[model samples]
Target: MSKRIWKYAFSSALVLITLSGCIEEKNLRPFILPELVNTPNYLVESFPGDSVLLIAAEGGILTRYADDRQYAFTVSNYPVLDQIDPTDVEVLYSGANETFWLRSDSLIITFSRERISNYRDTTAFYRPTRFYFDYCLSDDGVLHRIDYYNEIWDPQSGSFLSDYFLAIHRFEPSGSGLWESVETELSVRSDLLSSPNAVFKGDELLILTNPSYHVSSFRSGEVVAEEIPRESTFDQVVDPVWNTDDVIYGLPSEPAFFSPFDAIIELPLVAENSQRLRLESACSPSADVIGPVKVLKWTDQEAVVYVQYFTNQLTTANEVVGYIYTYGLKDGSCDINSVQSDPILLPFSNAIRDVALLNTELYIGTESGLLVYDFATLTMVPYLKNLFDEETR
Candidate 1:
């Protein structure tokens, strides 16, 4: 080839490559990477037919279903708070007054309505190494927060403090400032395990310690622990639901509920007792099975229970598949009508942490984002990611 032709071809190639690079950069600039963090705790407050979904993880993301728009805000956005870590903020309650209560290691922050900018540090608690908190609203319009300290190991002191104490804090509106606080401590060493699930049933709090359950009276401070009956060999009791007359416990074979007088009443899932729901392997098997009950919601005639089943195959390295089962209860009998057998694969190592139901849709919460499944269309959509895309566009 001639020297002039070769030189012209070389210059044209360089220009084309540069233009392609510029186009690629411009296309990537609009995409915002999600902040990977722990799976968030989800709170759904329903009214009439709509609901307000709150995702508290790497900051707070609020979605109002009525409008189908979401607001993603971070605690660090408040410069006065000194760039508080968003993962440290745990949502406590979403009130009817359009306010939310959140807690960190050291402070309890309250956000007014849907405005993240309008917030205040309402109160403070002991900055423990690890903690879990749950709250219940009373009939008299008082909010009660139960603070459970799981671990209090101080590295500098080399001491394990906060052994087994639970705190109950009551909050009520007072004039124009923060809510009034009344703190009470309950010695719960005998009733709680190292890791226990705390649930509020009316004025009483129920603590489920895997195979056993405990009930604590807020009025009398009386604690009662009940063991599983010897006849029933259920693997675990989890995802307790509070009903008007009973407190239901999620079991493997049958659904059991404790009466007001502490009597155990179990409802059969199937007509034949031989075909019971078994969560464990009968013998030494090739694969390991793990079933964890996540949530339970009840109506007047039926109840819906959500459980996640995980299978870890020993043949492959890190090969795990997850299945989500939704069982419907009618006439004291249970049957599975919905199953999501996705392989538990999530972006940024996230897992399906929790699930909730609103109207005809199922809301699934993960470590990174939220997804919604419509029963009528049998389709699932990424709710949180779509909101981010819309905002950026």
Candidate 2:
């Protein structure tokens, strides 16, 4: 009741609280946290069996290991001027024993996993035109870029001053880790090819001219265009997948329309008996499919397709989902109604950016984090966990 007695009791409670805090700090364990700069837009196997690399949309790069922890690039590791921004990378491509970043303002930066700090700038030699639309690294270590130029009509002049063109520029890796400009070929006029997608197979360049369903093949300084005969009346075919020149598979759709994944068609490129096969009837009837379809794995006898579908429409909120299906094929003769297997629907609803298969696991790069689907276990696991919270951890 006295002041001296109250003061003594308060001092004793303060000492007990300090001792408990010390004990709590000593018993705490280290928590694993994500070091990602931003959403992982692209995923690649940076090192064989050791780590996977995640690239953000704005040039942030993180290396994720099997234990779920990540390693991010420090300021001293990459040049400040050429440093990858964690908020703004456009394209991250890994091929031909190196990785490339198509940065802002037509800057092409390439680095290897072995020597990441020793990066080389490829755009210094090519310089800038109006802009670049797409790029790829060919089999022979040559970089191919689709360059575009806009033609502006001068009101004061009688004629158009600047002409428009879409061309492919080639760059080879010269000695001392430098890229040298080699050749440039005119693909087509700016308005000639609609939704043109270019890819390389060995020494030949294949450009898909959509709506027409024609593939323009360029080789040895010569160009040849051939049509993929259609089985049904369709407006356009997108996402062409083919390993060999003998056959190609694509989804037929009406251009500029957000529709369901109705059917996928196969076109043979043989000299004789070349025809298209529509496999609409083989798909599952109950699958509520939407969004664009992508063929992930393709072989002579089978193809693995990923379809984005809509779900949870009956509820207050709507969600988009994904389904994976396998389609079988016959060598000599094939039937359109007997190829599809049952679909495997994914559990999560995040928008997928990219997907890659390694051994029995499927690595899916989503807008939020990385996910892995194991075929052997038939289970999906979130590879990267969310940022650490002190209270939860």
Candidate 3:
């Protein structure tokens, strides 16, 4: 009860606090988002009502779908390239409105025009790459692929480059704006690889290869020139949807690629040969390989992401659960728990070939029919049901 006793008690408390700091606690962080409009448990809102016209992909039309027995709406608005056999045609996605791209099976054209939704302007054009053109994002969408254009300043070689730029491939709304080459047939496979959810950060376009992290650049399609270790900390780069540019490529000072997994990859309007800057990442994945995450629409405020969780319920026979999270580049914070549950359960996640977000509305293009959900109501309605019976969704 004297001074000596008081001193000893204070010392003991300090030691106890220090020891407690050394013990790691289990992480129980719940789903968080930036003012999520709907609960994560199910569809919360932002869906078309039943009275609204339904869209289906029964015959590969994106905007318009065949009704019970016949095609409905003004015209079929699906992606025509998706219907064409890839072996017979070459498809290239430009970074613009919902991945506007170009397609042609004829070498006589030898060029790609912007094609997506109702955006058809044969006059304006961009290069293409190996990309899946849904209504979301693309990796390295705005990245330019420089070939000749000899007048431009030489980068590594320091010469006025003479080769023609094969194509300037852009990924998201404002993604990496890097450089690629369509000079060779293997260029797409050799450079960008695959993975709809892949991300591009700095000079690294982290992609999902067969069994490795295929790291390239949206800038110079070449590696960083360092001895890229055969091994990478990332297991796989996947779910490579691209964000959209607010006003297409003509807009100045936009991002090249904004990915949930990779963050910002390339800065807009940078010199093609600019030294690669060591950009930072906050949501670096830790899995040996993580991919096929859900990609939402592109917004300047923040990027949204979702990871997959499998279930065994009859409804989830081969189900996939999507965990929604938002990453804010402007504020450098992530709302990992924007949902009631981290992984929102879905019975047949893979049943749908792809997903696109129109506002808060979630559209799933599946084998059977296109499913639209009203998040506010937590209700989902199947479109083109009878059509699915006749053909695939």
TM-score of each: 0.48, 0.53, 0.38
Q: How big is the positional error of residue 172 in model 2, measured in Å on the Cα after superposition? A: 5.3
lDDT of 2 by residue, 246-268 (tens): 56565654312134455555555
lDDT of 1 by residue, 231-336 (tens): 3443333333444545343443222111111112232221111123332222111233234343344443444544443433222223322323333332334444
Native-vs-model 1 lDDT? 0.44
94 Cα displacement, candidate 2 (Å): 5.8
Top-scoring candidate (TM-score): 2
- What's the number of clashes in each of the models? 1, 5, 63
Error of 2 at 335 (Å): 15
Model 1 residue pairs with clashes: 39-367
Rank the models by TM-score, top first.
2, 1, 3
Candidate 3 off by > 4 Å: 1-58, 64-83, 86-263, 266-294, 311-313, 316-320, 336-346, 384-393
